[model samples]
Target: MDQAPPRVQLITSDVRQRAVLAGALLEAGFGVLSGPSLEQADLVVVDGALPPSELAAACAQAHAASLPVLMLATSTEAAREGIAAGADEYAIIPCSRQELELRARLALRHARARAPIVAGDLRIDPARHEATLAGRPLALTPTEFRLLSCLASNAGHVVGWQALLREAWQVEGSQGGRQMVKTSIYRLRRKVQRAAPAAVRILTIRGAGYLLAAGSAPPRPPTCR
Candidate 1:
């Protein structure tokens, strides 16, 4: 029997943004440990708009842990400083959710590629821009791949619709103009089902959002236990 992967630890500044980011990662399936205090983090992701003293402190803590640092900077100059201070990566915030997921996975992958492989049947080769289930290729549209990659990276957690839209579509602001997210999820489900076992699932939480089921269970509609 195989064991599940350990969760990713996330540290961020703004509570609202942290909540949204946490939910997104959870829906994608990572056990998230959050703190405004970067000293306690395994992976410190900080706001670039923060004061230099604070950002520098966060970087110091990350360096102490030997943990990778990702910064959400407000400007190019800030990003440069973050790198100079030892951040592994820096990106502008309000980015599409797809970009976020891709970069996050790459960061982890770069860190753990030689550690050991914990992921299961789903194989995402970011470099190839491709994914396969149990060695069988999935016919995923590019958008669907980005969405699935986002969710799969944090497999056991719940991802909200708004975050998904931002990542998958790159549309900005807190607006829900259409319910096309549901449509994309549905299509992703069918594509995965074609090759995955019945036990693996993509569960939906009412009023919360969608997430891939952990382990091999096929996604079930949300249920009350």
Candidate 2:
């Protein structure tokens, strides 16, 4: 049997933005639903320009329904607010249509992967959009969680930057892909260190890529500096 295209419930107050986004998604082979109800939605895409109260209500409702949300925020602060309001992913407004489509697809992909991932002492629950280290919750944004999940899934192997971008952001050949991966990895490293020092290690393979391995002893300070 042929699978139906994933249905996206897109909500935005601005008619122009809604049309553009819906058209992009439709062109990308996704089914678009603009209705207020989420009865048949496989995912939800929201605009951050909506009044704060309304935005919160929409996200909360989606979260309660176990639907993954992708927010289009007008600014970085708006994006953070959306994430805090239960969105699983976000793209800043004025972004390319390709970026929007890719992010939406990424959210759907993450939502469909319900199995929990275990690497060393780190545990990633995709269905719940959560991760923990040594049983301590790691405060991670949606992007961070996805990045960690990718590295953990490929633990012990050098996961190239391009591969990480494709897995974490669902885009290929994007500009600044390497820098995006680098910045996210740096943040992930810090979070892991704070959560459970020496419990897990994300290693840089220099010229190759990155390796996530079970931690041994913490790295010693430079002997000659």
Cα displacement (angstroms), candidate 1, residue 19, comes to 42
Candidate 1, residues 76-189: lDDT per residue as tens digits? 888899888766777677776666666566656554432222246777766467777777887888888777777776566677777677777887434442377888988888
RMSD of each: 13.0, 10.9
Please, what are the lDDT tens digits per residue for candidate 2 over residues 41-128? 9999988888888889998998778788999888888899988887889998788878988898888876768667898898999877
lDDT of each candidate versus the true structure: 0.67, 0.84
Stretches of candidate 1 exceeding 4 Å from the true structure: 1-118, 173-178, 216-225
Error of 2 at 224 (Å): 47
Taking all chains together, the TM-score of candidate 2 against the true structure is 0.52
Clashes of 2: 0
